[model samples]
Target: MRKPIAPRTIRGRLLCPRVDTRTVDHLADGLVEIDEQGVIAAVGPAPAGCAVPETVPGTVWLPGFVDTHVHYPQLRVAGRSSGELLTWLERTVFAEESRFADKNYATDVAADLCRRFIASGTTTASIYGSSHPIATAVLFAALDRTGLRAQVGMTLMDRDAPPDLCLEADAALVACEALIARWHGHDDDRLRFCVTPRFALSCTPRLLEGAGRLADRHDLPIQTHLSENPGEIAAVAARFPEAAHYLDVYARHGLCTERSLFGHCIHLSEPEWGALHAAGAAVAHCPDSNFFLGSGVMPLRDTLTRGVRVGLGSDVGAGRTFSMRHIAASAYDASLLRGARVGPEELLWLATAGGANALGLGDRIGHLAPGYDADLVAVQVQVSDPADTAELLDALLFSHATEPVRNVLVRGRRAV
Candidate 1:
């Protein structure tokens, strides 16, 4: 007679983030005990006398990546733009997003987006839905079934958008309210509704303020764009004459707070940096998108030195890939261009733990250890047996050679 083994477990070579940039805990052969509630009960060297799943050598188990800023409706348009931000939006982006108004089209995209997330090893994400409420609802429904955690928002825009993509302030707010009521805290808060105001230029003052109020009333996180380009900056300045600067437009309207996540802050003045730090808000640094659009590089070193939180984003359609590894590679290049050396350990941290921290889910995610949610990704590095941490990271994060994700788990549930 065979006795059934107890405790659920997974094992492999592990690189666990302590949520500290200075070091990463690498266990050459490690074990993670997952509990009934799907939290990591214990993680370290595998215990003797306890039979466990066969450990896979050369498979590195790391935290599932948290994508801080991505647009769900813009998936199809990812690699099409060769021009700068505004022109590309008018010529290519708007039309693609407008098609989401069709329910069937939105449904298909929603399903495909979920599969793409799993394939890319993304478990948690902060996503921007299109301006259409029905399309956003379809997306939430799709995500709900797939066990992916996300905070989604219908893009709130009342001006300067194509007619098909624009929703009046009042109407947009109402739709947001409806969405929040249905899915704000679904599945024990695994999914949430965020307040997304597409950026200062596209949203009117009233819409932005209303969005801020809605987020406040529900205590939701906010996501928006910042100083990503020069012309965009000038346009923002022209649109809001009274604003001290571009950041102030959101600040004045109550969008700047500890729970805010601003994307592509590549260009900023001294005061802007100070204010951003003081507000306790975070940035979703999309190096891939910055390079794609020829936007200026974000001063990663200066920003981190100022104690501002940052997370990596695969700002798709604009960023070029769904893989965070690609984003990490681009981030390294960005730092080198700025004369700052950012190694693979820190870039790995940015892609996982840093992103979790930026999105206010640090305690639960960002690391693989006891008391943390069991969201993990197993990547088969190019080098089967790496000599050291640097070698491991080089193959894992920086190299152009693609590494396959062997397995993926979200809260101990296998998504792939």
Candidate 2:
């Protein structure tokens, strides 16, 4: 097998903030030295003996942003918000997702989504594919061709979704196991498996239990939805009468572990927060989707104070944008609406390192530090109105397509 090589010279005005949970730092006029194989060798001042490449100015370099949660099959249906979460799913999402059964269609949209993500400065994402294994495989193939680092999983729903989207419980588990065996840890671990169950309402106890078993056996990360909206919660409550709450359904099935990533945790209860913190599971705070669907704002401050791990998600389709910049901006607005404010540093951390941590990839991706993958982005700063550099960073927290992401590198190679 051929090995990947790093760039001879990666010249730019680097803007990496230390995204560690312990402390954060922002560096300007920085330069990153990449080794032969696409990984960061050094970051900061160019060494004395090194041949310096011509500098590229007027662009801010950042570690490629990580999106903790997104649905690949729903990429084409962005901004289709007519009603709340459940209604939107039935009226638009499920119907559009069902089209992934066509392999050609799946391949085309997968490539489109990958391009959109790169254009927005995101280098990695955890994505959910359609239930069809062939469709999921096509999505993976598209990502492989596109050069984005991703954990892509086939969506498993035994019930409640559209008839074409649903799968039999045992059959779905078998397919998931086969996929893991084939794709987990592929491409030097750039591509991975995420055992995905659509959600509690779409899955029966048998399916969730089987999925948990498969995940344990393969040691794969798990992804699913939680208490996203009142209607969805009510539907879950109605379906699982024996469970205490929405989280309880996953908890009882052993799906609430540190490796599990629950998306759209907007309307969670106090006990659910406690359980999530105790379980060491991560939450993907998808503010744009919540706002678009008319769902409640996520309790970001409360979750943080409770010591729960949180990251950002561009819950595309419902989220209306592929950029984590949009998600970060929406997050700040969501926090303000909930009577708490997130500073620029914190918001940047959420989009980069916080997201890496949420996906259990903190040490591997999401930073410009040595030993991390050389996944970086160059963003052109163009403030619409009068704003200083400090305000520019904050503007990224809530603006729409204001700045252009000029370059994207994944694994030391140019991606966009």
Global Cα lDDT for candidate 2: 0.83
Which candidate tops lDDT? 1
Error of 2 at 221 (Å): 0.5
Regions of model 1 farther than 4 Å from truth: 1-7, 48-50, 55-57
TM-score of 1: 0.96
Q: Please write out the lDDT profile of model 1 over residues 268-387, one tens digit for every residue.
A: 899999999999999999999999999889988788888899999999879898899889899999999999877888888888999999999999887998999888989888674565
- For model 2, the run of ten residues with the poorest summed lDDT: 20-29
In order, the Cα lDDT scores of the candidates are 0.88, 0.83
| True-vs-predicted CA distance for residue 399, candidate 1, Å | 2.8
Which clashing pairs does model 2 show?
6-36, 78-317, 329-397, 329-398
Top-TM-score candidate index = 1
